[model samples]
Target: MEKLIDDEGEIYNSISPKVAPVAVQNEMEPSNISIVTTNGTADNNIGKSKTTISLPSAAKFTNAAQKKAPWLKSLFQDECSAWETTKCGLAELIGTAVLVFLGCMGCVGSMGTPPSSLQVSFAWGIVVMIVAQSIGHISGAHINPAVTVGAVVMGKKSLTGACVYFVAQCLGAILGYGLLKVVTPSDLLLASSTSPAETFCITDLHGKIPVIQGLLGEIIATAVLMFMLCAMWDERNANNTDSGVIKCGLTIAALCMGLGPYTGCSLNPARSLAPAIWNNYWNHHWIFWFGPIGGSLLASVLYRSVFSLPQCSLPECQSLNTQKAELYKMMYGHGDMWDTFLSGMAELVGTGLLIFLGCGGCIGSLGVSPSHLQITLTFGLAVMIVIQCFGHISHAHVNPAITVGSVVLGIKSISEAAVYIIAQILGGILGYGLLKLCTPTGFLSSGGPEAASTFCVTMISPQVSNVQGLMVETMATMVLMLIACAVWDIRNASNTDSTSIRFGLGVTCLATIFGPYTGCSMNPARSFAPAIWNNSWLGHWVYWFGPIAGAAISASLYRIVFGLKTHDKETLTPISESIHLNSVDTDKSEVIINSWIQYRVHLTTRVLTLGKLIRIRAPYTRKKVLNPCDKFSHTIARYKSQNTTFYIPISLRCFSRMNLITDLLMRFEEFQNQVYRVRVSCKHLKHVKQSKHDQRSKAKVHNNISKV
Candidate 1:
């Protein structure tokens, strides 16, 4: 026996080790048996027996799960063993810390003479890109509890892993905030605190928007946030790339800018919780937790059900070259190490630019805050600019939430994610440093840093309550994510080219409408950065929990119901199978027939040559030498040892029509050997009859002579 076995114990190929020619066995049962050849003689030895042989059965092989199911065993371990639990947790920790630090710093400057919403939005957008680039390779840089939960639901992370990451992220956020406190002066820190007077301690929504309205805003915002994340990560979607990161960041910033005045969009629980812990302002904290969690869960369910990758086994889901660069295809299409480095560098530069331009815009306003329109334009336009510049490089994610979303959806590897996040954080720090370098020392001393911090975070108006602020953040972030999803979804052909424009405009719309109520933070990193710098943790939960929840819900809506349908649905049919051949027109029959004849003739020649070789080599055969001329004719077809030729004559065109000759060939195919024999017999019948008559006459004369 010969068997080919794969690394696993499964036998895939089988071949008989040896073959013997012998008589058929009497004991074996046969059904519908055809007699191909037989030899019979009048004299027979009755007592003799023909040779008999038996064939061995094929061998069977099975995996080593005889006593237990393989699926059960797999529960304790992954199908693949390369995943490192500790490394993933560490990445999550580092990534979260980076995001919180930069975002908090942005808020730190916002506390005194706060920059306009436009400036704040732009600054936060840059922060998102910086963190995403710095840490996107490791642990997916979720930096948010809601994003972690969404990852679990998306099947990217195990339940145990999710729990570990959540803890790491929360701790990382705290550590990041602590770093800010260490650097800023105690007096300046007080100015950065998240108080009812200066932070997201909402006491009213311009006296028109109620508490429920604020909550609705958060839900909607967070829904959009999650939806966009899923859309950007959808491989079935063409626009799922680094550019999606920029689009997402820009859109998210716009949401915050627009909704900032209403409820200060705190779309992430970690972002919100860190500052709240530092400041001990726990009022209406439950809203932040519930709103974001609910929204994220909803998004997860929707994305999985509607737009998720077709259900497939783990072994079949791996791609050989997933990291191929889409933006710089000529340089990085092969996905070499150089390409990886270049991608990371792109992220670094892009993130640095995001921070520099965003913060620079705010710091250069010369003391007076710009109007709402100017602020919105500054932020929205900055986002558009970065997207245009770096959209092709690292995708400029700038936001940890989107990175996590990509990982959960399997759009990126964990290692790559870590690199992106690390780069993002460094870029953010550099951007802030640049801002400080460019500003006058006197301005820096006169609440410049504090005001800059204010621009980085979300703060509720005095009239809005904590619950209302949480709701506002959640809804605002959700709406932002939803739009991001739409912009990135390639299925929506009309919006593909104008993604940045659409996203910028959307952010402008959100900021213009909701800037006064909660500050429309719509991002945890943006809100947390300032809170930590100013030591103002009040209502921080609203930023983290709300935005994260919003992201989750948005992922669900766009992936499932809102997203455009793809070109084709997944199916089990083989790629090579012919489905439409039957639908071809009769007019093309000539082409089909001609193609068939060429194929069959080639196959027939090979078969005939093999048979001839076998016969010539047979030792038992007693045959006369064949003449050279007869040999050629015999190779084609033979009847009663007569020289024969079977061919379509080219010179007989006048008598036989081309169509008729082709029709005859077609008939011969259906009837096979019988048709050929009949045709030959008909052509030579007269000659054969005459020759037989002469032989009979001669035999009669010879018999009479012998009798005489």
Candidate 2:
């Protein structure tokens, strides 16, 4: 009969009803056990069935059960969290909505006697900056669909997640435009429907701006925007710090300002599509989608593949890093109460000065209409003065954007930054309060929104679309940040003496170009303080969003082109200096440096401690020593801990060999009448081992006998 066996290998015998237990068979070897059963086929009449089972040895079975677990799958799940995806999508939505709505409001106010580009820029730039600051912590505020595509192509985001973001951003854009429509008058909307304008969806039948040129402009501008974004976000880049998101907003604002006049600077597809859909204007619609996407993709590919930062191999740079680490640890990890207080005060005082001087110019101009140059200079000069006054103290980072940028580059600590920002905000309120004291109440109220604009960040025209103003601000802020980094680069020697003047000139230049459109506020603090004090929040987000985006872009560009290398030659240096065996036996050397002694001493006595040889000259003219032996030993121990090295100068012709002891005693006694003190070098010294005490004794005796 055939045998039947279960998965556990317990065999059953149908032919033998009273068979040995399966356990007894299992205990025996496989060859010793046998199972007998009925015939293979089941017999219906007899009701008997048969089966045969084969099994691997228990050793082999246990091994097959102990295979490696699937760790890679678990890791993948951890890396891609469902919560993170949802958060990113939501942030994109809010960020886009903020950018679109404020930008539209700025456009609504752009139609005036002169059609100021400055007011339009201000409205758009601030929106970008604020949105970045608000939601940048979540989704990176990639409100533009072009950016989303670039991110995905660069492998920073998953295709599915990026698609989700794009959908959210488009919806957010529609929502922003809807809000703009509700606030705008129908008559004004009709007059400035943008269907007849050549802003976003180029409707110009004239050949002045050929469709090709418009497309090229979009490609170039969007390329620059994407290039900056990639540089800032690259983890390999040393300069891509904590401030990356804000800098991105600033970079966009700068690009927007510079390119607004040409092809309307529609660097974002979502931005263009939002308003186009609202007004039912679709002239040359392909340019917006094709140009930005193509440009951004090109930039992302080129930057990721072609560009790299310069490496540093200097010993000095290594030493500098060590010192920097010490300083950083002291300031952040173990900072005393006084340092924190000083840093806070520096920010407070510096910001106060900036607002008082900057906003004063704007308010004072109420009586006589100041030119854009005057306003720009006022703001730029204010920044310069604060920078110089507090540069050493607080880094004079009166602007929050600059502070964030510095932190990202690893130049500042987060706690210090928090304190600085808080101080500056409070300082801003104080500065505006002081301005109120000087200006007449009637003048402040008489102009209403027009008058309030002088003391606040507001839109001045309504002809430009929110998208158009945002683009202008983005371009302008980008230029401002680019120049700011250039001037601040320590490697550029020419910038050393004229940093303040150069920075002031740079800001003034930006304002002159973009001030008429949007007030040219590259600094968020400069905008926020005035707006808060004046109680004017219209289009305020543009100021924050634009400058921050622009700055983030600049941070990336600076890092890729000029950031310091992570691996340095100095870091490879041995932690402690190695002893030179060859130098010790050289007859050419007479004096040795005693790192323990701060001041120079003659070389007469050679003492070897723990294998380190130290030569000391004692001017002994009398029986008593000028310095106590215990005190000298303590000094040596202290110097040893500090890694200091000392060199002693020796001269053979100064004394006869046989009279060395007598001469040294006489000299030391004579020196006792004078005040001879020791000095230590500012730099740390390397350790040199001294010989054993018994060895030193033997050497002295041998020298004395030889001389005799």
Candidate 3:
């Protein structure tokens, strides 16, 4: 008998009567297989036998080993294909080249009639849109180095990729301008009647426009551009991409039109660098680079940290989102200190921006003073921009009057209101100080031969009395407060799409109508800043008293007449019955319970869980317990009639582990509250109408009796 074992651990037996076993021939390589043969006699009755076994080859064994470990193979693979990276770089290069070539070509006067500012602005805007649409899928169409930096900061692009894009963009800009120079006539490229000498498309400050002011203008313009980009890139806005290209184009055009006179609105360093290199004109070139890059960095970080939606994958991001939500609830729904510091900071920065931009636009440069219309529009648009940028963070209450109004409406506590006012005043002062630093001494104040008034100071007309000026300020502020009330009304919550624009136009109208009388100083902080800066205190008391008085009166009246009544008398009556959980699923039970509580109660409800016990609480009362593991079938629900706690028990397995149900319940409650507010407003309006009708009837009867 003989026994043979193979590599698979299977044994085979062969028996022979002969003394010696048959020999086997091997044809494979020695290293490929290992074989052992042995012959022995177990007993006198058994004959000699041989055993043989086969082993796997070295190559096969190595392959099998590699299959067991995948990371080893992945370690050697490239992160991105070289060809794909090259293609992306090339796309950025070409896109940037196209942008420069087309954008500058429009500014060439020799091609045709000299293009107006409007034409030039629209040309750049349209070219940007065209390039974005063409190469947006490839390399994200980052034609500007500033945009590339922003992308890197946002983690949308790797550092190495950003470096590649930056180099490509710069080279493309140079190539594009070089090509333009070749095609355009020498007269147009050089000094000519239409084009300034050594300027071409090179961005520069207007005559008498201080370098600091120019720098500031470029920074502000680029920041706005970056803000728009961040908004477009937000995950929450993922579904709103159809009109992104158009909106971007229009935004650029608007910026150019607004800031072109001051700094040429060179929001792209690459775009400005191209013309400067072509013309060999480097005056204030650093401003273009530093301003755009700094602004892009600032805006990108701000949006990511404060404004953008949180990514749940990151713990810090989730925490940030929670803090922001809590802050919002504290400000609008309830009171808390979750993020009051951040809110105050936002108010401070927002107020500073409002003052700086609004007052900066008032300064006259060179020999040309801004028109009344320009000043009016400037202040209006400044307010609009500030509000749009900081509204989510702090409600952009850049005005003391607005803060005061919030206090009267119970949206802010007295302490919170005080903090906001102090921040606003300090921010205004700081903004004016920065403005004075940038402005030329001659342009800092009014009283040149052109009869320009003090820079942004609200002055009463010499012909009008202080009392009359006070009335003008008071009435203007009253109108402004009324607008705020309408915006804050719960009934108008869904109609906030164009709120910034509406406020802008409203300010413009007020300034246009009442500007000559009292400068329409509807904001005390706005008026106080320039007065402090210029030391012009004539009729200053009127500004402070008028706006504050107007805000308080308007807010109080609006709250009583049009606002939601949150007192016990107006609270919705809760259901006074028992809720039985019989054969309902977890989700359905939750929905039914939430609906019952939300529709019946007037308070905001919150649900919390600890182990197997669930606690439900309203902002106005203590917590109520619900045992999820208990066998109880029914519980009394008396929250509607009185503010007290109650208990209910049900199976815990029916509830979801996720917070999705809780979010849905909260949203449902908010919707119900909005509906309730609408109903209350309608009822009040009906009562007023009926009272007027009865009074009219009584007056007619009295008149008839007197005639008889």
Candidate 4:
């Protein structure tokens, strides 16, 4: 008789009276069993019998089980459902309908003497904000076809999904307008002599605006909108979504106010299409479609290719060592040369665009000068738009002063700062040259002979001396640098959703307060450009010297007062020591393990309570002998019950031996600090106990000597 044992610990006995004793030998494969039997004699009637059985491997059985039931496999998969996509599309449809209905109702002239541009702009902006906030999570609230197109170009949406979104948006828009028509009076829908259109909100060129100028206006305005959307969608700005809807609404309002006079600011093709279909007004309608679509494609592609930051995998992002290495590389200026080149180009283009748009807004013809408020809003919004477009790529330091401040703060190396400064200066000159080429002669010379040395030149007023002008510029630049430093501070990293808006409004505030004194030229590059182009360098040194001094001082002060210190040594030492202590005794091992368990319990409780730490003081129990696998599994189940995610090392999860558990726990860094602290305390207690025992023994020996 022979016995065979299986992996499950079940034994099987084989008996055959006619056969000789059977011999069983273990094979290299655990699943393979071999049995051999020989006859009692060569001439005997009984013959030898050999039987071999091969059992299925556990892995093979598991794979077969998984394949047999696909639903079981899908339980662990993270794939999105078809219903989720349908929900998104439905949300888009409803969001678009709401936007159009509210926006067009606000534009209805029949309600009164016709609302002012500012009123209509605010209405539309508020409506957009409301709709976005309501449905943003469900479908991203892409009420505009241009936004959908931009998402497609950025690879954020599939082609089929985008097509569905477009169709839904169109239908929603049409439905919204139809509902408006149903509610409004019939005479209100008719065209008046002043309107000359059957529809209420048909977008068309105003005054004597040429078709090409209107087209270009629409394209530029829509491009700005798309750029802001792209910035909001970027992964680096993932945490900045709290006020994203408000930003979008304000951006739309600003675009409309700035460009409404020329092109009606129809940045959305669907918004324009709905009204055209209602009133059958198609004159120059192609501008609305081609302009927005073209601009969306252009801006989306540019942002994705040039301004988007590289994203790391989850493992890399979670690794402290990798983060530290990258930080060190950046601080030491050892980053990729190609990235540096791209950053330089971004700075160049960003500065050039700033100068062109900002200075262009300053142009006034004849007696029609732009109002102070207009100038303020223009420069502020221009700053916001430029930053939104290029901030992720190069930090959007369009000024030499900001570059200098960055160098002082250790955010940029000397070489990188030099590259940025050169780019800014060159960009400024190029931008001014372009502005001069485009502006009419009298417009560039708007401020009369004395004040019209050149448009947008940073010159001191008659009441303010060169010294006063320098002080004003210095103070203003200092404030701006302080804002930059705050934005770059680690404490405020998660609160960058409205950075561009904050900067824009800050510029507006400073300019409004100090414009009459020195034109509020806090940027040396901005002042240098007009001075260079106009060949007018009166008190130009003040602009350069004041901003640089202000930047250096502000950067130094911010670093001294507000910088967060990194404790790399303190954070890394415990982990290293724990990893080295692999041969601890059973008592020390138990101490370490118990300490780790306590730490985990505390951590889990704190997380579950949303930062409220809960204290648990339970004595260690040894009623049952549990292996590491059981302990780990129990801990994991407890964590899951509290809705906390805990990851145990795979090796530790299957550990069957105490020594194996100790070895793996020594290498585990999560609870290493607490474990090491407990271990040291245990050793100290042991030393104290040994000293007490020795003292007692010495006292006893002395007592025996006296008694004798």
Candidate 5:
């Protein structure tokens, strides 16, 4: 890629047609132009170069685009299309597996008769930070079945992939846990008293928590989970999608770790089912599943309909390679705006599973405090792990309001954000439903009022003034939202900011500090879910309205007074660029200029962002386009001692879109032309002489697969 006049240019590559229907060389007309794929002397490249004038000069393009032109339509056959559902589907399956195995395992394995709730909670938190970094690259890490369903509905994935993702998640859970059983210490398992009831129950209190009380506890907790899922990490922010999941972990852990002592937090059905199956308890499982699911639906619908703006405008045709590079394509292959929403919906549903586990642990009969630190730890850890496990696919909002807020803030595109919200609600319902099936009343006669207290959303008796509680809650939420906005900001999220993930840990710290008061009901949607199910709607308005208002205020303040900005929103600063791809559709809408090439790309990037890589392809023959990374590399590589080789796979076409390919013989800072790449990697003879160390000849021969 080269910037021609007016900061625009062209790049040239010497290569043979790949997957060509006709012999490319045979079809060349009298006026022929083909790059020589080999290293040539400076004289060979420039000394005898014929810089002659031509009769018909047009913009330089690859053979793939030529096929799309109507004039040459009959000259070629169709090229392979890699941006198919099958690819995204496979990604989703693997992503879901990663999330479930790690997240759920953290919840079950960490709980025991003697354990620290705070430590357990961090387990989940750590999982979110680690797994997201790894799994995000695969299928967008939709690890949660619910998230997969949502993204599919949002048009991020084909329906086929979403279905496959759910199945994959369930199977993965069984397999992951089965493996854990083999590796887990026998003594640790013997003392493990972890359960939904035990984790949330207070040891001093005794008796069954009325259904209404238990239900209300779940509602607010799940609502808090949902709101964070929606508002904190939407890619619409200036950051990465995982940012929202990261916030969810912190917020949920706050409730589970600190508030679990009051009421059981059964926010997910899968959590309930897993423990119930393990413990053989089946009582009032319906409340757990139905309440949270219903609450999730209500919040999703309310958020979508009441408070939001239109989302990003989505183009119909998205290149697969481009999507992969931009997002974490863990198990679920990546998708564009439409598909991303679908993925978010899958996250919402998967969150239901999380609630089932965390909340169920709180409600599990044996979960009473002092002796049950392990239960509290299990609850918090569950959240941490799930966020890590499912951060990629669907943005893992897991809550409708977070998705809604993303839209309101112009983070999400209008294309399919609704699907994600809906899927989350449905998934929540299913999660709770499964919980109901697993827990029958007779199973937990041991759990007393103390246990019931753990799941209750009660306020601490600070004996403080009304203003104090309001101020405390307000300020806490403000700080949380501010951090969330910062993390979600695309500019920051897309860049290297380990600090954002730490913010999530910070929220957990806040819970550790403020757990005694206000119950940290940071989200109203959480309160809403269980309240409706258990007929515990008392003071529900406080949980719902208070946090939202606080969040809104914080958002406005951050966006206005503080001048913080999200990626797709009104931003505070703009970086200059040395080169940019002026993407335009051809008259036929078939020519897509996409590829990764070495070129002179002149752009001022505040930071390197893989998401910004340009892609240009007509039919096939893709290349990696230039973005900030190229500029940074040129600037940084000069001081480095070792020479590194870089390779881009042609299969991921979109990733190469708008790639600024440079001249093969001459190194450059930023500039591109069609004459470049005339002699790259076409002819590499592996003639290695006897040496003490392995020669680099073999590596050069496989340049296409190597990276510098």
Candidate 6:
């Protein structure tokens, strides 16, 4: 129902029925235009502006008719039967059993008469690695039933299969544990620590860490872990590109290791339950089960609501949606024009969040410094959590002026600079507003050196002078930015996710090194959020001015000075830049970005040869420009024919067949991923004819596309 673009001459995302022929739009466009095939666009979405369109469903074929067209079902059935074969299922079951055994074995070993943190931690993680590798082919080896449950709750899996998976996992865990009990030596059991879980029960009975704190810990940890899972599983996440068993394995393993000490890492109830049962650590079982499960449920709802994008309503799932309205479009900060606006807004909001959580959190109104150790750990952890919360959305810039400075320094844009700054300032005050709603005056009391009693207040003293603090802040920002750019390049527009956890820990490490000096305002936004919130805006400029100047100077210094900008002109990493717009401006106002190409297409399809680049407009019925060496053959397969090459998902209807300039386009991201894309050919079209169920969408996917 949006603007219908005539690329060359193909209908990109309109309602095109299989048998009900429709007239294709052909005039008022320029010679720069060319038609690309719509042949079963892999996705119903045509362009980045995918709009939802309702079309009449295909008429169901009768038995007689189906018999006449035997190819319909027969051709679509699995050939070698990969991904869902019985062999895959068996491999999954065995893999699940192995994971349970090893994870339990590690616990048993760690809790043995002589407990070892590293050994136990590694053991639990190793199970994830081993099993992920073993059954990853058949099933994404989700060994723990709870994780499967989490996945289903998160909508990554179906309820029916998740239920079956849980049952299988429970049975496997029981068997693995039972076997261990039989094989274990009594001496080791006697020596083990009665499970460090006793801390939850010790409960200074009331004052120190009330039952609420323990519950909160479990909730927070579980939620963070679940969020990480979503990012890692995202096919779009550069970290998850062509996701194999290894990436998934490392993801779980890293989570277990990093978060193990907190709430005993009960992100998975199965991991906790099996060990707790054998160890008799059931007193706080509710904290582990209810808390984590509750958190998981909340995280699922939030993620799906806020981040899980909806499929386009376009006839096909096209990347360049024909709809110009904002409702159906997802705008990123790095994207052009409107995208840049959204990106700036995101920066503002994200930075505001950063300031509120990191700085506000640092000075929890506890005028006293707990043993230096506690201050170092508690504050550092708070920063880690905040980073995880907002990293993906705005690159969690949480700082307005860093990019502004980058822009001024020629690394970013100055035209829309005000937007980001305003967003950042507002987000800071907003965080302060929310902070007031919580925090009892008592919790604000002198707990440690960083506490500010005004509840919303941001000012406080420091161990060092402002200059000393400024230097430290600048140094810290330099480190964080480098790591940030490395992990997330705006040009690449991708986040390292949990893969580059060392970068995440880097913040904590900085806090440990510089917490005493000016409270180490590595991020200007971090410093500003609390200042605006607490009404203690005095000396606010120091936090804002100091960190901003430092970040800008450092971002340019390292990125430009050292040639780190190879990723993007902006020192910022690309959490959204993973997608590049390789556009072709047909002067007719049509632009087409090959979503599947190694690089991005910036031209809107309306400006290019519609979605098809092969055929010209009706007035210009020029001969085809096929390559002398079968270039036309490949371009057809890559662009129109959806048999084997990478193409954009146009829609359910358009995917079946396409006619356009089918050609192969290739490029690579900083990580060296070779993206091979091309148009479909007649031979490829033949393959699509034989396939069924979202044929166009399947062809557009970037994975192992069949032979063109």
TM-scores for candidates 1 onward, in order:
0.41, 0.38, 0.60, 0.62, 0.42, 0.54
**Which candidate's TM-score is highest?**
4
True-vs-predicted CA distance for residue 51, candidate 6, Å: 31
- Better model by TM-score: candidate 1 vs candidate 4: 4
* Per-residue lDDT over 1-708 for candidate 6, one digit per residue giving the tens place of the 0 to 100 score: 222325443222222223332213233434433223233121123334332222212121111101222322333334434445445445556766676666665555344244344455456556776777667656667665545656765545655456556666656655665566677665443324553433311111123334665566566556655665655454334343343343444434443333343344555555555555565656666776677777777766666556544433222222322121122232211125655555555555445434433333333232222333333343444444434444444444555645555564454566656666677677766755544433333554334443454433334354566666566666777676666555544454343545234443566677677665656656555565555445566565666666667667766776666555443322222111111112222233332222211111212232123344322111111123222323332222222221212332222111122211111111101001221222212222223345544675686773446544
lDDT of each: 0.49, 0.53, 0.63, 0.64, 0.42, 0.45
Candidate 6's TM-score reads 0.54
511-558 per-residue lDDT for model 4 (tens digits): 989988998988999999999878999899989998998988899998
Query: Tens digits of per-residue lDDT for model 2 on 354-408?
Result: 7765664454223234445545755776665555444544557777767666555
Listing every candidate in turn, what is its Cα RMSD in Å to the true structure after a full C-alpha superposition? 24.5, 29.0, 27.9, 20.2, 18.1, 15.5
Off by over 4 Å in 1: 1-83, 109-113, 190-211, 314-708
RMSD of 3: 27.9
Evaluate model 5: give its TM-score: 0.42
lDDT of 3 by residue, 1-708 (tens): 344445743222332323232212122112221121222111111112111212111111111101222333433343556787788889999999999999988877655476656577779989999999999888788899998888766757766677788999988999998888888776666323656657888888877787878887787778777876775675534444665665566556656655676777898888888888777899899999999999899889887776654343222223334323432232133234535666677677778777776776565554335567666766776676666666655677889998998888887779888888998998999877876766666666432343333667888888999999988888888888888888877677556556666787789899999999988889888988888877789889999999998888888889888864322211221211101111222222221121110111222112223343343322122333332333343222222212445443322222322322223233323222222111111223335458789999999999999999
> lDDT, candidate 5, residue 274?
43
Candidate 1 lDDT by residue in tens digits, 1-708: 233334633222222323321122111212211111112111111123221111111111111112223332433443323467677777777777777676666655435664445665566667776666666766666777887777666666666777777898889888887787788764565423443422432212223335665565455456546655655555434444555556656655755654444455677777777777877777566656766677777777776664343432221121201221221122112234554565566555555545444443343234334465756554555456445534544455655555544444344578877777666556655644544543443332222334544554557778999888878877777787776666555567455545566666766677677777776756454445445544677677877777777776776666667644432211222211011211222122111111111011100111123113101011011123322323432332221122333332111111111122222222223223321212111112334457678899899999999999
Residue 541 alpha-carbon offset, candidate 4, angstroms: 4.4
lDDT of 4: 0.64
Write down the lDDT that model 5 would get. 0.42
Question: lDDT score, residue 392, model 6?
Answer: 46
Which stretches of model 5 miss by more than 4 angstroms?
1-32, 39-341, 367-380, 399-405, 413-429, 442-473, 494-504, 568-708
The TM-score between candidate 2 and the true structure equals 0.38
Which of the predicted structures, 1 or 6, would earn the higher lDDT when compared with the native? 1
The candidate that wins on lDDT is 4
